[model samples]
Target: MNYTADSIDNLGISLRTFSKINLDTVFIYPTVANKPYQIALMHKAANNTYSVMDTYNGVTLNNHYIASVEKKDMNFFTATPDTNTNLGVTFRAFDSLVLNSVKIYPSQIGVPFQIDLKRNGTVVNSYTGLTDSTTQVVNLNFGVYPPDSNSIYNLVFASNPLINRDAYAANTSTIKYVPGVIRILNDTAQGKHNYFYDWKVAAYNYTEPVPVNFLIPRDTAADAYKIVFTDNPGAKRDLGTTTSLTVPDGLTINTSTDQGYYNYFYNWKVRTNYFKFYSPAEALTLFGDASKIYIDYPDTANSQNVMDYTYCSKMFTYLQTVRMRNTLKNNVAFRDNLVSTSNLAFTGALDAW
Candidate 1:
C-alpha cells in the first residue's frame, strides 16, 4: 500500500485562474518513475513564484509546482514548510492492562518515518517506517509493559512530516469528559513543541474486568477533548458503547480512502475488558461548581433522598451487588413539632423525618 497521494486543496493551485504558486508544501506522491535520492527541480509558476516538480514529470505539472519531497532516512526533521516541528501527547492508561501500542492519525501521508514513543518525557522506543498513506489509523507497532500505576503517559512524535492534522476544529468552546479512554489535545504551545494533535492508543492483557479509568481534564480555553477516535475506529478495537457517543460539531475527516490502506498499515489494538468513564473529584470542578454536578437517581419515588454526587466505588453485576457512596452527607437535629407527648428516638435518617 505504498502511494504518493495528491492533496485535496491542490496545495495552493489556484482553484480559479492565475494564483500564487504553493511552495510552502511538499506534495505527497509515490517514488515510482522518480529515482531515489533524487533532487527534482522547482517549477516556476509565475515571475518569481516557484514550486518543485517530479524529475520524470518534466516541467509545468498541470500549472502547478513541486519541491523536495524525498525518501530520506529521516532520523530527525528540523521543521516542515508548515513549521510543525514537534507534537507530543500526555494521556492515561488502564492499570490492569499491559500496553500494546499507540494509534496515530496523520494529517497527510507520511510514507517513511520514525515515531519516538515517550513516557514522561523520556524516549522508550522508536518505530521506524511507520507510513500512513491513506490518512487512517497509525500505530506504534510494538509492545511495552503497562504503566506501573494508572497514570498519564506522554507521546512525542519526534518526527512530524504530516500537516493539516485532523482535530475537533469546530468551536473553541465545549469541553467534554471522556471516560474509559485516553485523549487530550492542547492548542497552546506545549513547551518547545511546534504543534499539538489528537491521537489514541490501545492496551491489552486484562486478567479480570478492569474499568479503563483515565482522568483526562478538559481544556477550558480551547476545545479540551479534541477527538478520541472519530471515524474509522481502530481495527479489532475494544467492544465498548462507542456507537452511542456524541460527536463535536466539526471533526476533521481524512478523505484519502483506500480499501487496502488500513489492511497494509498495522493498527495496534490492545485487548482490555472495557473502557471506564468515571470522572475524578478534581475533574468535577471543570463543570464550574461542585453543587451543580448531576447524579443519577435510582429511586424514582424518593428523589428527595438523592445526593449531589454518588460514586460507584466498586460494581459487579454478575456478583449481584454494587458498592456506591455519597460524596456529601449531612446530619441535623429534628424535634417533633406536635405538642402531644410521645416518646420518640431519632434514628438520624432523612426519610424518617
Candidate 2:
C-alpha cells in the first residue's frame, strides 16, 4: 500500500517526496510452531526523540530515512513460552483454579490462591462439584489425559467468556492473577517436566436442567383439577395436583395457584429450553429405542440434534437391524460410516464462547 503526503503545494505538487530506492522491513511472527515472540518497534523522530511500541504477532512497522532524517524503525522479537505441554501431572491438568474464601466472625479475613494450566481453546475437559469449603474454592482437573497432540495450546479460560476470574492471589479484599509460565513443571517440585503454564482463568458453570415441583392448593371447589402438562422439561404430562406434591425427578415449584398467584416454577420450566442427562444409564434408557432420539447438542450452540447426524442414523439403524434379524425380521445388508461413534453419553456443556 502506498501513502500520500499531508498537504499539496500551490502548483499541485506534493509536500512529501519519495525516494527512488524503497526501504522495507520484514518481520516473521513468532508462533507456537517456533515459540512465542513479542516484537517491539523503536524509532527516532525528526526532533530526535525515541519511542517504542509492541507489535504483537500479526502487526509490523517499517521506517525509511535518507538524509539527516532521524526516524528509523527497529524491530526485535521475544519468544513466548510454550504453555500447554502435559508435563505428566493428571488431576491438576484441566482444573479451574479456584481461590478459597473463608473468614471469621465480624472480620472476614481470608487468603486467595490461583492455579494455572494450559489448554487448547477447542478441547477442554470438565469436572463438576470440585470444591473446598475451607478455602471456598475448587478446580476442574481432567485427570491423566495427555494435552492435545498438537503441542500448541492456545490461551483460553475455562469459565465465562466475557470475563475470566479464575487466577488469583491471596489477599483480604481483592485477589488478582496473571499467566506466569509456559511450561508444565510444578513450581516447587525438583523433578523434571513437573512444570505448569499459567494463562488467564475464568469461572464457568455448566448448563443444567432446572428442577421444579408442583402443588395443588386445597381449593374448596374440589373439582377433578389435574395439571394438564404440555411439555415441562422431561416430565411430559403434569404430576397430578394432590395434597402432597411429590416430584420423582425433582421440581422447583412450591405452590399450585393459577388465578391468584403465578407459578414461578412452571414459568422457569417454560423458559429453560434444555435439560441435562443425569447419567449414562439415563441416556441409554431415554435413547435406546430404534426410533431417532433428539438430544440437545451444546457444542453446536444446542442447535443441531445429535441424532440427526448421518453417523448417528447409521449406528442406530445397524443396532436395530441386528436385533431385528435375530428376531426373524428381513435380513438386509448395509454399510455404516465409521466416523459416527459416540463415547459421550451425556451432552457436554454449551460453548462458553
Say which candidate scores most in lDDT. 1
Q: How many residue pairs clash in each candidate?
A: 8, 19
Instruction: Quote the RMSD, in angstroms, for model 1.
Output: 26.0
Instruction: State candidate 2's TM-score.
Output: 0.16
The 0-to-1 C-alpha lDDT of every candidate, in the order given, reads 0.30, 0.25
Question: Which candidate achieves the best TM-score against the true structure?
Answer: 1
Please give, for residues 95-127, the per-residue lDDT of candidate 2 as tens digits: 122322111011111322223334443454442
Per-residue error (Å), model 1, residue 303: 31
Model 2: per-residue Cα lDDT at residue 123: 50
lDDT per residue as tens, model 1, 1-353? 12222212212111110111111112222212221222232334445454443321221122111111111111123323232445554544432222334333444564555666566666777766655643334444434344443544555556655633332233333222233333344322422222332232333221111121222222222212211111111112121221112112211112222332211111111111221111334225433344432232233222233331345323333112221211111122323322213322333333353
